[model samples]
Target: MKLSIIILAKTDTLSLFQMTLNCIDSFYESEKNIDAEIILIESNKDYEASGFKYPDVVKVIIPSEKFNFHKFLNIGIKAAKGDYIALCNNDLLFKEHWFSEILSLGEDQNDIMSFSPVGKPKINTSNSSFEIGYKVMTHIKGWCIVVKKEIFQKIGLLDETFDFYFADNDYAMTLKSKNIKHALVYRSHVVHLEKQSVDSEVKSKNIPKELLSKYKIPKYLNDNQYSWVFNNEKNLSGFLKFHNKWGSPKLLYRKNKLADILIKGKLGYFNRFFLRLKF
Candidate 1:
């Protein structure tokens, strides 16, 4: 089955586009069985105006309005004719044989909706599996994920509810609710140049207080739910706090753990404890 790669891109980051192309080129160098088709979903006219060339890219789709990541991803998925579809951000760089590794995983497990390594932990060679308990939450970094076309048909599409964050988790949760399995293929890896599309300085100053507050862990989550959200936040905050010292990662980690236990129970404690090992 051919592999169709879809990259949701904007006009500002041409370097990121080049990096993605290089990643695809490396994939082809290692594995020749796959037919790679790229769909560049662009919302800006500057990209068209720049006249950047994607020699290997099969098609490009430019939207008239501002880009809605999830919506455009759904559009690309529908346009894909391959048996397997890969959805990724324009900033990700894949390792050679990444597609081959995903194909290997899919060969034995047809139920998998998508598969990629958990990027929270440093990418390394390790083989382990444990059920996350609450519900399997897929980060969908928009960096690297491979899914069968049928799964997309079954699950409908990414919920437009989340214009940015939580859309992937929501989609994974939806698949889990229907008993579909999601796997993590550690062997296939991608380096995510996170938030490369958006200007970090602008985002830091411009994102409203309300939006920042929205990303916080809600008070209502149960032990497992709280643990999941807390871990996700901790991962993000750990990196941010590391570089900027906005707050102490240790303090935030402990505070979140205590909050989870107080709000939920022992399950939260265990989840938090388990997460700490990775840090």
Candidate 2:
């Protein structure tokens, strides 16, 4: 299968850029029939002259003062040259045969709209027999997703108004409206170096920290791979905007664990997560 690997590059650090590309290369190194194009959306205008470069990555420079995640992703989405599109962040690392693993589970379907490979579990459990190594979810995480190009043709590219967050959830809602199902590829997984772009933008560009208050991240997630789960936030602007448009009891509770516990008491459905998630 042909695939277009789209990665968003939004940080000032060149090492991180090269590291992400290296991970991509490793994922592709073992495969021969999988025709794929790797594309990069460089949010920094100066990336062209930054002197740090990769040999084969197709770089599109999108210089924006306030980079809109949906807008930039749409840009890469349009430029991609494969039947399948793989979207990833600049901070992610991958295991070997990542492409093959994702394709193994998704290549034949039209409705399996999205699939993500989760990393290996520290301790294996009873559910280790899951074919893809990860459990299926309603929405593939924004950090990494493999999907058919036709899905976009059906529902349209991401809405640019979302600015920084919930773009995936909004897309998931679109899928829901059409009754599409997404999945998580259990065996195909990667290590996400979490928020390399956001941290750099915050440190270098002075973007506010409160922009991430809408969701809940676990406190136990101290490792780099788990970094995407937590952020330092202290406001509600983002939260209100997000929930106002797409809030549902399930979606809200899934994002904010505290809310689920407070509202559900002993009946919160999220407790099923512990029973279901063996990894």
Please report, in order, the local distance difference test score of every candidate based on alpha carbons.
0.59, 0.61
Tens-digit lDDT string for candidate 2 (1-279): 688888877535767667666656765675556787878777767755767666554555564655777787888898887888988887777776776876776756544666776654333364742232122232366788878888887668887767665566666555544444566666676777666556433333322446544345333333576443333231133333455565543554454454234324644344333322322
lDDT for each residue of candidate 1 in 1-279, tens digit (9 for 90 to 100): 788888776655667567656755665675666777777676666664676656655487876756665788888988888888888777666666777777877886665657664444444444543112222334344456678888866667876554555455455445444445566665666777666675443233233345446454333433453343333443333333222321234554564455445424434324323432423
lDDT, model 1: 0.59
lDDT of 2: 0.61
Which sections of candidate 2 miss by over 4 Å?
A: 30-32, 63-65, 122-139, 200-235, 248-279
Candidate 1: stretches off by over 4 Å:
118-141, 199-202, 205-279
TM-score top scorer: 2
TM-score of 1: 0.66
Q: TM-score of each candidate?
A: 0.66, 0.68
- In model 1, how large is the Cα lDDT of residue 97? 72
